[model samples]
Target: MQDADKNGNTNQTDGPEHSALLGRMLKGEKLALAKLVTSVENDAPFVPEIMEEIYPKTGRCYSFGVTGPPGAGKSTLVDKLIARLRAQDKMVGVIAVDPSSPFSGGAVLGDRIRMQRHALDEGVFIRSLGTRGTGGGLSRATGEVLRLFDAFGMDVVIIETVGVGQTELDIVDIADTTLVVLVPESGDTVQTMKAGLMEIADVFIVNKADREGADKMVSDLKGMVELNDCRETDWKVPVLLSQANQDQGVDEIYKELNNHREFLDTHTTEGERKAKIRRRHFLEILGHRFVKKVEMLAREDERFRDYLEEVQQDDANPYEITKTFFQDEEFARKIFGATQTKPS
Candidate 1:
């Protein structure tokens, strides 16, 4: 879709400029990669074009999502994971999704002080993204950014979420393997299950395993996993212990992650999983774009603006209004006519 500037003129970011940037990125230019990531995060008009150009270069990277409660040592775990991947001579890329400041729209904990040690490593590429008030503990552009990292030749791309919540489990929609981190005293095992963590976690890490109640927590998670049995695959979610700060038990956690990856590679269910994710991704983008197009039309059409005003004032119920609006042929003709030629 084409975007109009505040002056109501078409503003696009396509053409030779973005093509040159993509070409440089394909040649392993870090600066080009960084620039493309920034453009994606900002939702630049040229993103669709960039995604089209790089589509063939993706699928080589293994994406992992490290998510859990706040103060669960997720950053430390990610740092250690990056080290492990790098030790094996694999290039790693990290997308640290941090909470955004309501006032500034910037990440409150960008750079995550614990992970700064890898800042200078040539094989390690790290980018901190502000959630920007989006739900699901990640930015809307995170999936696109991962595509850029994959195209840039990262063997493994890790996304550290902004603390998992009931509705913040979108990481599972993107990651090939999801590691849900928790602490010893975080809460009861039932609470974890109620929080929707049980369904999304492929591997569980009880960080700060040296703390009190560590063993009990591990036992509880294993019990819960067993109770919800009747699985299609032989892989059982392993609740491993880890003192990430001390680097103890991390190796085993990495081993479990590898096992999970191997399971996905070998199982027939792999196709089903990918199909599910593809459906979710498609629906999400379609919904976002459809809403955006309607909003743009509402801004330009007098009758649509009046409809929006009525909805805002509660004079008409949104559900009925949406149904009626879509059924109106004139409404469809006008809106479709305006957006017929998509931005290149």
Candidate 2:
């Protein structure tokens, strides 16, 4: 895929001239917002350079992630949250992750559609992200966008992921605060919660609270939460009720979020959260380096392609070829050239 120019949604331009994009983003230039995000989404070479220029002004925003099963009213809740945040005169950025359609390889992109009322509001910046075939429920660019919004001086950045299924727990690594939403009387709430979503919840919201069993569902969640890890004494995860469409009980939800952020700001939780963020960024960097090294080596090493052709032709057995693929001296040489680090 092609990237945009730094001034025009970030194209394939190559040079220090694009550095102004970062400065313009921090200055709250709207066009710069689109362009800078384009660079991050495409993993353009200019991303690191842009981020380095903007790094000092980063981390001003409180990052919150709202994640749950489909039909749990997460989008509605997020919409309500944005309303509350905006009433306080806060600048907000929302990144909504939509599932991609396998057949079409395009996201429905309905999240932004649901949020159309805010499209005209200058204080609210919202972007829709397709998972991009990641299977992991979030787009690869979600974290990078979070940093971008923070550097742009957003007061709060809320990220909503496609559903809180198993590996989609990747949200925990990226979000400073995560809210897990559920419906009342979903029968399998406990079973689904057992899939690790319960442990990740800083705030448990019973969205669609006007529904028949909302209260009962909230009670059941509280019961399960206590029995599961009641040992935290006062560390209970609050279960708030919200009728997202009607905007009922959203203020209290915001209160809970604020309280959780305050709790996390303490000395102990502060270090742990920062450490996790560091590790998350480190793994991302490592993944980028890994793929780049493999691609560069495969391009430069003739033996690498030769081995593949051999495997296809049955001139080499799987096990023997695997050994050769790794131990090939040229593999080491190309990798070292790409990564600037020696292979073990």
Candidate 3:
């Protein structure tokens, strides 16, 4: 969720015990399943330790993030997508995030119930993460968990975000290909084009296409695409219509996805660009971690507060406060010790 400490690999308590357990889980040890879930679900005392042991081994999966408006039927879309993927003998991982309502977790778990036909199927692993107010589209450990599945050798990882509003469109940070799903009736065509979604989607899907207005929505999407100003290349972001519940157009989607993958594979500059983006994102996460830590320490430290009070009263400025905090050898050492010294 939005809790600062809950998101990163900074929570390392058990120096070795949790590491061995994480190693086992990565090695296919069955018992580690419950332990890992428990560690994450209860915000376990040693999760920071667990993430540290597992972080480096991540970034190994094709992480796909699925997001859209609340009633876009993202869950059902994922279910149908999984079914099609399973036919290819591909291993799939699903991460569903929901709001902070008391039944949020229960509702997400119920998605598994909707797709129970795949319960006995080994090719699928379904996980439901309560959003816990980690807005901008995902849970705190969303990327980490996708990496876990990747390290586990999952062929595909699907992330489902609860809300698809502007503020919730955080999937772009994690997913290589983020498909913004919209139903015909939701007026997603106009909502999407007007809200800058045209750039976010590598592909636009109009789900529930069997409805009466479906064709108009699809045409509307195509019109928007044609009117798109970015004509630098022949690559047009395709708009596809699908009736997922009826098992329609899944193959076309697979074909488009594969084509996109192929495009990335051949584009030489992509590697460097992606590396820069990833580094920037990790740095932002680190920045968030640092800001939270400083805030927490300042609140708990009398010296920092007296200085803050003086600054608030305009008797002293931030530069002086910053100088005092940095010049205080004891405080400086503690802060540095508590923070990660390495960039990675």
Candidate 4:
């Protein structure tokens, strides 16, 4: 019998099946790409093999991460951006991560509803994901899905994060250009600063610019940017106003996106920024895998269960128990494979 996770994905798939799926995905098959993303999101058994097969084919697509507070019209702005990209004959992929429904554990805001005009466009591929009770505005599998889209030959991929809190700031670590959208009524300059928006925003946009405070909000963002030397490059963060509902000021956003991409392409610090992002991604993957391994060990290892029981009974200090556990080479070998050596 095969074991299943909370997502109900069983751990018995063969490598050849994933290899075939990857082959189809690389050939620009939309259905295959969707299936690959679903497998990654479900944490299927063959995901590591699938990723390895597609890893070499990635890094061609340029990504934009759009984020802001809820009800700030981010979806509408992204819809406009997609139209602009489509005008240039670009093949675009969109990953819209929405907040999960507390009751159903599914995506609450379906971005397709806002972007229905592109439903029949063969050049565009759109996918929506639920937060799945994870933090950082994105699901844990978002990076994998982004990689799949890149490998599937998307010219541009836009990742729209759940616009809920400052925790959604993980988008900055992944996007080539981070576009932080805000509205006049979303919050004030101080609140933006408090939300850590100044540090992550490569371009600040005041959507729904027809509102009364839109110009003032743009002015405030500019002043804040000038006051805070947050950017690592010489590229100045541009703050623009946009009424997305009317499709006004969106062309400027497209122009600025290209300008920012050009700046990064030629900037001396581009390599350093990429290196930092790689380091962050490495640590995140390591931490997640480590925790999952520990959980699996705790569930199956009788010794680990006994240790947990001792800790729960207050018969032994957890710190000492953990210290002893690490010093046991046999236990380490059993849990992390025979290749793992115990620390001195």
**Alpha carbon lDDT of each predicted model:** 0.75, 0.70, 0.65, 0.74
Question: TM-score of each candidate?
Answer: 0.87, 0.83, 0.79, 0.87
lDDT for residue 258 in candidate 3, whole number 0-100: 73
Model 3, 176-233: lDDT tens digits are 6777777888674466445466666777788888887888888888898888875354
Q: Model 4, 53: alpha-carbon shift in Å?
A: 1.6
Residue pairs with clashing backbones, model 4 = none
Per-residue CA lDDT of candidate 2, range 52-145, in tens? 6676677668988888777788888888888888899999988876554331112444433367677679999887666442323244577778
Clashing pairs in 1: none
* Each candidate's clash count: 0, 4, 2, 0
TM-score, prediction 4:
0.87
User: How should the candidates be ordered by lDDT, best one leading?
Assistant: 1, 4, 2, 3
Candidate 1 lDDT over residue span 1-344, tens digit each: 33433212124445688889999999999889988887776666566678877877887889988987777898998889888988899999888765543321224434463677887899988887764423232445778889899999999999887567643476555888899898987776448454377678888888998899989888988887887654456678998999999999999999998998998888746668767866876777666556556755655666777778878874678998889888988777655555453222
Please give the TM-score that candidate 3 achieves against the real structure.
0.79
Candidate 3: lDDT of 142? 62
Task: Looking at model 4, report the run of 10 residues with the lowest lDDT sum.
Answer: 102-111
The list of candidate 3 runs beyond 4 A from truth reads 1-13, 30-34, 37-49, 99-107, 111-113, 133-139, 192-195, 230-234, 268-270, 305-332, 337-344
- The per-residue C-alpha lDDT of model 2 at residue 29 equals 97
Over 4 Å off, model 2: 1-13, 101-113, 133-139, 230-234, 267-272, 299-301, 311-324, 338-344
lDDT of 2 at 198: 65
